[model samples]
Every structure is written in C-alpha cells, then in structure tokens.
Target: MTTAPAGPDPTMQAIGQAIAEGRAGDTTSARQKLLSLWSVIGATGDPLHRCSLAHWLADLYDDPAQALAWDVRALDAADAVTDQRVQEHHAGLHIAGFYPSLHLNLADNYRRLGSFEAATEHINAARTHAPSLPQDSYGDLLRGAIQEVAEAIALRDRSRRASAPGSTA
Candidate 1:
C-alpha cells in the first residue's frame, strides 16, 4: 500500500481560478484577484508564487513596456525557484522546463518594445533552454512562438504578433 501525494494547494488553486477567468475573457476579475494575492505575497514571497503570479500578470497588459516589467519580475523569481518547489504543485514539473516559455515571453515583449538586442539575447536563451521542454503540445507552442519572435526581431518589426498573449484589450 502506498500513500497518496498531498492534495491541491489552495493558493495555487486560487491562482488557477484567476487564470481561468482571464482565459474566459473576464480579465478584470483575473487581474483584480491576482493583485489581491500579490498584496498578500509581497515582494519576497515564495519563488513559485512570485514567478507564477508575475508571469500571468504580464499577460494582462497590452502595453509591451508594462508587460515587459512583469515578465522581468517573473524571470527574476524563476531564478530563485527549485525543482523541488515546482514538484510540490506538479509532480511531473521541473524548473528547467519553465525557462523556454519564460524567456520567450521576455523576448517577445522586448521585440515589441523595439529592443532587438535585448530580444535577441532572450530568444537565444529560450532556444538554449528549449531542449528541456517536454515533447508535447505545450512544447510545440513555445517552440513555434520562439521562431516567430526571432523572425520578428530579425526584421526589426515592432508590431505585436496576433498570437501573442496580451494582444487583446
């Protein structure tokens, strides 16, 4: 007989619910809830919470600069996260697998802000971490998006990609 792993984290579940609200087009509620959570978490909170919150918060902003701010915060927090911490919420998850998407988002935001040099650096970082991504739909999506952002950076295009998150109002 084996013991079951711990149940869902209520805080993470709340974050997921807010993220779902955003996905459902009720972004105001999502942003507000996340903001409320942020107040509780403070700046030096759990690395996972900081990383997750900042990443999702970045997606709520239409302005590239604003989005870039949140993305930077996410990346900063990501640096402090441990694989063990990630496994607490997701048994199969590893911190390494998170880098590709995190870097890709930063690259996209920098690209949109006309910071090609910064964007190129982050895109390269994303590609460097790409191998860590699982060979699944999520991996495919990030890989494809990385290519798209890289091409835009090469062309010096400042317009947002239609498929990019935070493109809508």
Candidate 2:
C-alpha cells in the first residue's frame, strides 16, 4: 500500500497553534481562531480536522453546556473519520483509538450537567473502546480516566473533578 506524503498538515498545525493559545491562557483568541477555522471547514469538511478542532475547542470553555456542544461536534466528526484518514496522519493511528477520549469527554460533560443516564452510557462506551488504546502512558491515562469518570457516574457526582480534562483546578 502506498503511504501518503509525510508532510505535516497545515490545517492541523493551525489547530494545534490555536490549542496552544488556549493552553497558554489566551482562550478568547484561541476560541475565535478555532471558530473561524470551523466556519471555513464547515460541518462537511475534513472529519479529522473537524474532530481535532472541535475536541480542543471544547476545552476552551468552562461551561459544561457549551463544552458539551463542542464535544458533541467532536464525536460526530469522529464518526465520519476513516481509518485511512487517520493512517494518513500517522501510520500506526486508527480511528478507533479516538473513541475512548471522545466518549470520555462527553461523559464528563454530561456528568457535570447532571445527566447521569447519558453520562453512564458514554462512560460505558468509553470502557468498551478502551481496548483499542495502545499500552502506553496515553492509554493508561485514558484507562485511568475511564475508571475515574465511571466512579463519578456511579456516585452521581455532578461536581467537576479536579483532574477533569478541561479543569483549571
């Protein structure tokens, strides 16, 4: 099978830059940049770009509702992402590897919103997809997060975890 050119994607670089801006505490400009990119990318644009952008965009907001909207967009775009598309980014990457994090984020948002049932559903989904993760620190992190969110779901904890992905605490 022929491999795609190994050049970095400019769109992804832009998204990464925006994410860095947010992490650097310039969330407003980061959000603006991501939204502007979203406007250009549109809903039907590159699923990988949409998924990555929406996933990071969700982190820019502290509000569960707002974050939930972006998380949902990320999940939807993830569904459209093909394994080939993911492999194009990196040879070892797979679309299935994206689900655990995507679902975990959704579960966390739903839990914070006090939607216990929905949170439970997504946490379960995350668990089911956990096996797709590589046996590395990243995989361990997601597995640990899955357990943490599942515990919170069972406890009916509506409060945000200090360790939650988007938490500044």
Top candidate when judged by lDDT against the true structure: 2
lDDT of 2 by residue, 36-112 (tens): 99999999999999999999999888899999999999999999999888887767688999999999999999999
Model 1, CA-based lDDT: 0.89
- Checking candidate 2 for backbone clashes, the offending pairs are none
List, residue by residue over 60-109, the lDDT tens digit for candidate 1: 88899988998998999999999888888777688998899899999999
Off by over 4 Å in 2: 1-5, 167-169
RMSD of each: 2.9, 2.8
Q: What is the lDDT of residue 115 in candidate 1?
A: 88
lDDT over C-alpha atoms for residue 12 of model 1: 80
TM-scores across all candidates?
0.95, 0.93
Per-candidate Cα lDDT values, in order, are: 0.89, 0.90
